[model samples]
Target chain A: MIDHIDSKIIALLGKDARMPNNKIAKAINVSEGTVRNRIAKLLKKNIINISLIRNVNQMDNPGIAFVGLDVEASLKDKIAMQLSKMPEVRFVSSLMGRHDLMAFVLADNATELSHILYQKIASLEGVQFTESSIGLKYFKYDYKWGRLLSEAK
Target chain B: MKNNLDNLDIQILDLLEEDGRASAKSIALKLGITEVTASKRISKIIKGDHCKVVAIADFEKCGFEFLLPMGIRVHGKQLEQVAEKISSLDAVYSVSAVSGIQDLEILCATKTLDETVELLDVTLPAIKGIKSITPAISSKVYKFQTDWAPLGND
Candidate 1:
């Protein structure tokens, strides 16, 4: 179980995973060892993972788009897994709505994106309908889970 | 030309990708370069805003199963303002201006369906100019990766 301190620590680490325990402790008013122990426990429990992740928007002109698919519900999970295996597809989900599966893909250019969408994803079995939206710009792209805990309180 | 990462910088990035907290000494030892050189390269990469180290929260572990994949249509020219408004909400993970039948696409996550409804039905409606919202609650998220690498250039 995570407490308020844990959530705050997670929030700080969410901003910069490389933050030292001492810095986190100073900011949150806790012992460095306490901060370190909480993080270790969080990691052990699979609650959080500190990773070196690239901010894709910062990358030059790499094609970023969202592809929504209406798949045969029976094969929804299978199709989602298939799309997830593709190199271009970064995120895939089985969803409940007009579209059954949604994927976020990245490519070098429009041509590559077209190839993946038409020749690759569209050709897959169980994909009943497909619609895509090229991301024009990111208004907000972040993953700040701990903030939710704070806001809810 | 203006801002580019050479092979050496890319290699250092690769090392950091595996472990962002790897010290300059450790990176230098692996790459067979001086610690100062590794540190300098790392600094350059950071200054260029090429990448970052971040904590990835597992919603399933955080006690949530999935996020809501939503498409919102906003009225007139209020799209950008509403997007910015939604951006400030912690319930949302991402908000993007997308090209298609829908004007905006948002990813929202919460601990329960009630919270999701509160955010979508109550809070979001309070944002002026939101025309309509179509949401597909995610039952399973197979893959979600933030770590990225630029395509190779010669």
Candidate 2:
């Protein structure tokens, strides 16, 4: 379990992935080296990933979509591997609901979305059916692992 | 190259990355710094435009059932026009004009499959200077990390 100080560090990092260790230490009233050590440990454990997230809409030809896919049980791994090969597919997962798989893909426009679905997705052997839903707006996106991380100062 | 940021800079970035609305005072309190210093640093970074802090939604809980990623190839210099039209669509979540032959990247989440197909078939093709499209049906999202590393994560 993350200790009190560690939790504070996590909360701060979640808010700003770019926070320096000195500030983290100062914020938590720990030594700068102590903060550094803790962060190293966290990274080694794969508890945190610090990276950039660009807003796709701000770009030139942005396209975003959500898809639910049903695949044959026998071809689950094969289909997933193939889907993962595509650059357009960023994230993929198996769900516990009506659809067996859920995914996020990036594209330039509607025409690109169609070609991928009709040609790429449909052409796959195990893909029995595919359904897509386009995102209109993002009301909230809390990647802070809010469930696991506490908000206490 | 952008010089590596210092401690104060990282602290400010961390606070905003989690919640863009966090005040400099709050960040200062958390970081044991004067509010004035925090505010100044934040102002400087925003002016630089390294990144932006904005509000994002959880579409799944918001009742968006269909979400798919699309790749669009453009004809001529029609990137700007096609992007505007696609963004105006009710289903777009995020759009990316990538560096490549394909040109644009789009993310969409909608209420139904029919809407997804209609937008792809009817709305997108109508945009002139369009060439080809590729759709990657996302089956799962294992992880998403928006915040880039400070000098310390490494």
**lDDT of the candidates, in the order given:** 0.79, 0.61
How does candidate 1 fare on TM-score? 0.89
For candidate 2, state the interface root-mean-square deviation in angstroms to 1 decimal: 10.3
* Candidate whose lDDT is highest: 1
Q: What DockQ does predicted model 2 obtain?
A: 0.08
Best by TM-score: 1
lDDT of 1 by residue, A11-46 (tens): 898777878789999999999999989988887776
lDDT of 1: 0.79
Local error of candidate 1 at B32, Å? Answer: 2.7
Candidate 1's C-alpha runs over 4 A off are A144-153, B1-3, B149-154
Worst 10 residues of 2 chain B by lDDT: B145-154
Error of 1 at B123 (Å): 1.2
**The candidate that achieves the highest DockQ relative to the unseen native structure:** 1
